[model samples]
Target chain A: MREVAAAERRRRTARLLVHGALAIASAATLFPLVWMLAAAFTPNDLILARPFRLWPEQATLANFAAASEAYPIWRWLWNSLLAAAAVTAGKLALSLPAAYAFARGRHRWRDAAFGFVIVTMAFPTVMVIVPTYLAVVRLGLVDTLPALIVPSIPYIGFYVFFFRQAMKALPPEMFEAASLDGAGFLRQFVDIALPNVAHVVPALAAFAFLGAWNIFLWGQLTLASVENKTLAVGVALFSDIEGAQSSWGPLMAVNSLAILPVLVVFLVARRSIERAFANR
Target chain B: MRGAHGGSLQTAGLVAPAFFAVAVFLYLPIAASGLLAVLDYHPATRAFSYAGLANIEAVWRDPAFRVAAWNTLVYCLVLVPAQVVVPLLLALGLREIAGSRLAPVYYACLFAPTLVSFSVAGAVWLPLLNPINGVLNEMLIAIGLPPSRWHTDARAALWVVCVVTFWKTFGLNLVLWYAALMTIPREQIEAARIDGAGFFRRVRDIDIPLASPTAFFILVTTVFTTLDDIVGIIDVLTGGGPFERTTNLPYLLWQKGLVFFQFGQASVVALVTIAIVALLTFVQFRFVERRVTYA
Candidate 1:
């Protein structure tokens, strides 16, 4: 009985250690973000004068106003939203059909076609930048939101792979039953496969939005005008224009605006997104 | 038989858009880049001239390209293994508290930084690493140590970039590792325990084998992103340098093309970077594929 109690004690100690270590690691990992939040709320002078504090002595909305006045932050935020939404819809529209075809449609080169799309995943996105930029320039799409959105959607290798996997897991009999009912490939896809795999769509949508919202270098390279810039690209430029002095608060406020929407989206889709990665 | 027969046109219709878009945007660029590497294109003048091997040869012999190549290696070496191992270990630890109340808290906190863009991440860290009244230095001074220059110093710049990039990127791997860990049959670990296997032994004998595919996946993705994602971070944090100490091949590609508009030099850098990527990926398949097969 004493020995069993000792074993329980040892296990409890191990669990405590694990929890403690994780807490510290998580805090360290979150330090920069936490600092950004704190600095965002504090007044500009205090931000420059004092060291990092978890909570400001007094919080203010002045920085948000300043960030907006200094740059077209609201415009940038809208541009970010428009770009992210378009890219997400484009990814879903393009990939869903392709993935469904790969999963269910009949073609001799079906696998090869899927391979053709999926192999692009290995092409490090930067490798294609110079040429993609030239294509955009030649097509007169630069300095436009479409410059960011249209080229961005072709990165659907993972989306196709993911949705394809989700569709493959469906009951094949459903498709056959639809086929027997004279529902063609389109009907079977729309009525059967899409409905069945609806659960995974939001998770992919969340990822797509987050991915597009965070587009940086491409946004910088293409959206050269101030108002045309997305929030991700704007924040970097904001810091450059503001420098690190009395503007730390506004700098961080803009950073917060860039991050908070994604945080809310992550929270909303947390369970489904967790399930998505956990399963595959 | 149902799987074998469908209207060819319908199937083609379903697949054609993504097929064409990817081909045009993704594959066409490689060809474009190949041509651009050999022929000079002046953006201002809109003139193209055949330069033959001059661009490639110049890039091959350039000291800056050599430096960037070396730095890229440094990033891959430091980050690839660290990304895989740190996250795996954390996932292993988190398994102890998997569904506990604090589990989601830890997940959120660790993942919070990832939701932010790399530029925002760099912005967030900029103030913290600020040489003047920065928190890091303030804490150092509190402990009676001098506040060191963070990313501004060429010697410290690369490590600073690596840390920021690691912090920004590791959350995805951690999540992957956690997911992989969850799928391991609990009974196997329990069986090992009944057989007197310790934790490390079980991780080696069961968990590693079970999680090897995810580990392998993480390894390959980490390798790719280590060379790719740091560009934004480097751009925001150090702008690739006090003396280009932190610039990698991707940054070099950006500088050569967009910044300087040397289309030929930029295309050469792009091609060379892609070649390196292809080589690394091939090496991973040759050596790592054997280990990833246990799944």
Candidate 2:
């Protein structure tokens, strides 16, 4: 009876300790974002006030209103959305069949080609920036969306490889059955393979969207006009180029706005996001 | 059987478009960069000369290039360990925490910064570090410390950049380390505990050794990722300013090629940077493969 009581106490203590540790970690992780949100809502004058108040005396939308007026927030958002959509669509359309072939088709050079794709990832992106710029200039694609979209296609080799790896995990019997049913290769992909790999589509799309949206170097170097600038490059323009004073309130407001779409995507696709990392 | 043969050919045909598209758009540009590095090609004059080793030699001799190289080395040296260690420590602390219910909430909080772009991170950090009217300054003043000029001061700028980069990326590393930690067999840990091992001993002797492979993987990838792609942070934060103290090789490539229109020289810098990264990655991979034991 005494031993049983001791065991129960030990179990209870373990549970309590675990709960306490989790609470502290969760708070630490969320602190910066909570602070950002609070600062966003706090009146401008109260933001830098001493002692760092957790809650503002009064909440206001003046920062957001000023942010919109200070920059082309709507235009930047539209540009980002369009570019991200195009890149995601382009990557999927291009990667799907290639992945299918690599996964399902039998060929002598299959492994070699796949290996080539992986090896290319080792090439530092910075090394190719200058040459790519030259190519874009030669193709008259500077300042155009195609310049952004086209360069991204080759970089999707990793994505294609990931998809192929995922597809390889599916049973091969399905392909054989499809072939027996008079379905050709294209038909089989449409019917059997697509359905099997559907779960990975959203995850891949999220990866591509985040990648294309946050592309700052390519956009900054390639796009010359403010009209063509994406949200990242636009927000960067707020920095004082020549020791001019910068507006902290409007800058933070714009920064917060710029991250909203990605934040929304992450929240909505939380499962897929977790799965992508989990699988990796 | 006849359909199978035909199906294979059709599949290959279906895949050709993508392969070709990537070759033209991705591989072709990379190849062109290599070719351009050796030739003296001025965009303005449309002139081309076989400069051979001249551009490479210039990059080697330039003091500014050397500074950029040193800055990159220092940044990577400091960041790789911090990124790995902080996340690993957090994951360790997380394991002791119960209530699997809070796991998702914690993950969401930790992983939040990964979704946000580097540009946004730089912007947010800028105001917080501002000398005047900045929260950091206000906090320092309250604590009886002097204000810091953060991005403006040459000495402080690199550290500020490092902190911002860490904030933007540490979450991703946390997830990776956490997943790796999960893969450690519960039985082994329980056995170690039953043998009278303490918490730190179990972690240091058992858990870390088991997680070494994952840690190594993160290290190599982080080096490449940060070295290759951190130009965005430089552009947004310091613009490699206050005397170009923060100009790493990538930004230097941009400065030469775009800012100065010295395409030939920039290509040289890019080539050298790629060569260095590839060499280091290869060496690190080979070294880690011998030491890392996979469960």
Candidate 3:
């Protein structure tokens, strides 16, 4: 009885130790971000005040107001949304069909062609940026949002890879049965394959949406105009443009705005995020 | 003979659009980079002349490129191992409390930083690390410790970048590690415990071996991301400043190409970095992955 009790006591202490460590680790990981969100609401003068805060002592919308007045902060947000949404839509439209074909289609070069696309997943972004930027410049699309969106859509390598995995997992009999039912290739893909993998779509879409939303370098390179900048690029340059202590609240507010959309999607789709990485 | 369905024409039709997009944006640019590496551009004529290996030689001899290359080496050496191991350690801890009431909360808090953009990651850390007005030093002083410059100091800037990058990225690997850990059959672990395998012994013999494939995956990705993913962090936080002490190859490529308009030099840097990454990734898959499965 004493041994059992001692063992139980040891387990309890170990559990307590683990819990304490994780609590501190989690809090330290979140401190800067939570402080950013908090400072976004704190008045400008007190944002830099000592003792650090995870909550606004006196909350106000003045920071948002100031950020919007100085830069096209709202417009940048809209632009970010427009570009990210289009990019996500384009990724799904392009990748799903290709993934469907790769999974169901059998041709001589099918695997080879799929391999060709898969290879792009390994190409570092740096290798392609200089030339892609030059191409966009040649086409007179620099300083435009389309320059950002159109170039990024081709990064469907991972999307195609993931969706192909999802499709391959579906029973082959389903596709065969659909074909026997006189469902054509397009109809089979749409009517049979699409609905089954529909559960995976939202998760992949959320992941893609977050990726597009957080694009920084491409946006910085392409979008030159103040208003044309997305929230990420614009807000990254916020301090450079507004060189004053007063810019702190507004900068934090805009930075908070930049991360909010991705954060919400992430929290809601947390399980899916895990599954997405797990399956990959 | 059960064959996967669809004719060549059908496959062609479905795959063409995506292939076309990738061909234009991805393939064409890759080809262009190769061409630009060997070609010289004159703004006066807006034309390219074949310069052979001149661009490569120029960028090869550059003192700044040399510094950037060395810094990148340092980053990979330090970050690649840390990136792989730290998350696995965290996952082990989380596993201890896997089903507790606060597991999800702790998981979410660690991951929240990952959801932020790399540039915003720098912005997020700036307020807390800002030299004069930052709260970190305030807390340090409060604890009776001498305050230190964070990113502004050349000696510490690269380490700061590594820490931030690791903090932001380790979460995904954590998710991966957690998933891999959850897959190990509970019976095997319990059976080992019955045989008197202690915690460290169980982790070493059972957990690490079981999770090796995921470890390999995390290793390759950490190598790739360590080289490229921190460009935004470098750009925003330090701008590779303090005399370019923190500039990696990718950041240097960006600065040279767009910022300095030296396209040829930038393409060379891009090619060099790409070669290093490709070789490293290939070596892992060839040798490391082979042992991972066989051993």
Candidate 4:
């Protein structure tokens, strides 16, 4: 009886310990964000006075007002949404067909073709930037939305690889049936292959959306105009303009704004995001 | 098979658009980078001429290039291991608390930063890591410890970049590790427990090997991201500042090509970075992945 009691006590202590550790780690991880959230609502002067306060003594939306007034924050947000949508759509449009081809098409050069795409994933954008930049300049696509969206689409290596895996997992019997019914490759792809991999679409789309939305280096290089910049790039510019002035509240507000859309996207697709990352 | 050639041609047609985009935008640029590495560019006249190995020699001789190379090496060495092991440890901790009411909440909080852009992340940390009025310094002072310069200090700048980058990115690997852990059979663990396997023993003997493939995935992706993705955070936070202490190869390329218009030098750096990536990837797949015991 005493041994049973002692083991129960030990288990309880271990559980408590685990929970406590997780709580602390989570808090530490969240401190900066939570602080940003608090500061975003608090008045600018109060943020400086009460740096450690987790709650705003007097909350206001003026910081967001200031952010919008100072720079084209709304425009930046719109640009971000437009670019992310375009890039995600472009990636899917390009990748889905390519992935289907790789998974189902049995040809001598298929592996080599896939290899060519996959290898580009390993090469960093900086490696290709000089020539890509020159090409863009030559085409006069600088500061255009197409420049932002078009070049960004080709780095679909992981998407193709992932979609291929998803496609490969689908039962071959369906494809065989479709083939027996006189379906060509394109027909099989659109009618059968896409539907089977529908579950993976939201996850991939979320990832592509997040990736395109958060694009900094490419956006920075291509989007020269203030209005053309995405939220991520604009926030950096906003910080540069406001950072030295120590305008914490408005900056935090804009920072919070930058996180909101992705946060919504993330929440909506949380399970899918987790599943996508979980894949081997 | 009937119409096999025709079917193959259809497949080729389907793949052509993506292939064309990749070929023109990606491969052409890569090929051009190699050539550019060996050629000199006149920014004013927009002229390119073959310069032999001078670009390579110049890149090799530059102190900033050397510093960038060293910082990149340090980044890979430190961040790669930390990115792997820390997430694994956190994932294990998370695994312990899995299925609890708070598990999802814990995950959401940890992953929240990752969903934010690097620029926003940098912006979020800027105030927190600020020297005087920053919350971090405030906390330190409240605890009776002396506050220190975080990202502004040359010695601490790279480490700050490391921390911010790690913070913004580690959750992806954590999820991967957690998923890997969840896939491990509970029966195997229970049997091991019955056979008197201790926690460390079970982790070492079973969990580690079973999760090897995920570990390998995390390691490769982490290395590439540590090299590639942190450029934004670096651009925002330090701008490779405190006397260029935090400059990595990617940042160096950015500064050289775009900021300084030294395209030739940037191309050299690009080639070197690509070679490193290719070598690392080849070595990982060729050697390390061979031993991964996939379930």
Candidate with maximal lDDT? 1
Error of 2 at A73 (Å): 1.5
Model 3 misplacement above 4 A:
A243-246, A274-280, B1-4
Q: Interface RMSD of every candidate?
A: 1.7, 2.8, 2.1, 2.1
**DockQ (Cα-based) for each candidate:** 0.72, 0.53, 0.64, 0.64
Candidate 4, residues B24-44, lDDT tens digits: the string is 888899888988888888888
Q: On a 0 to 100 scale, what is the lDDT of residue A83 in model 2?
A: 88
User: Which lDDT tens digits does candidate 2 get at residues A48-126?
Assistant: 4542555644888787787777667778888898888888898898888888878877666666767766566566667
Candidate 1 to truth, TM: 0.97
Winner of 3 and 4 under lDDT = 4
TM-score of 4: 0.96
* Cα lDDT for residue A231, candidate 1: 92
Give per-model TM-scores. 0.97, 0.91, 0.96, 0.96
Model 2, runs deviating above 4 Å:
A1-32, A42-57, A241-245, B1-8, B98-100, B204-216, B292-295
Interface RMSD of 4: 2.1
Report lDDT (Cα) of residue B159, candidate 2. Answer: 87
Per-residue alpha-carbon lDDT of candidate 1 for residues A1-280, written as tens digits (9 for 90 to 100): 9977987898899999999999999999888887888878889888777866888658898889999999999999999999999999999999999998898788889889999999887888887899899888888998999999999999899899999999898887888778888787788888988988887788889989998998888898999999999999998788777554458888889998998788887778887887787775
Query: Backbone clash tally for model 4?
Result: 0
Better of 1 and 2 by TM-score: 1
Could you say which candidate leads in TM-score? 1
Worst ten-residue run, lDDT, model 3 chain A? A239-248
At residue A3, candidate 2 shows an lDDT of 73
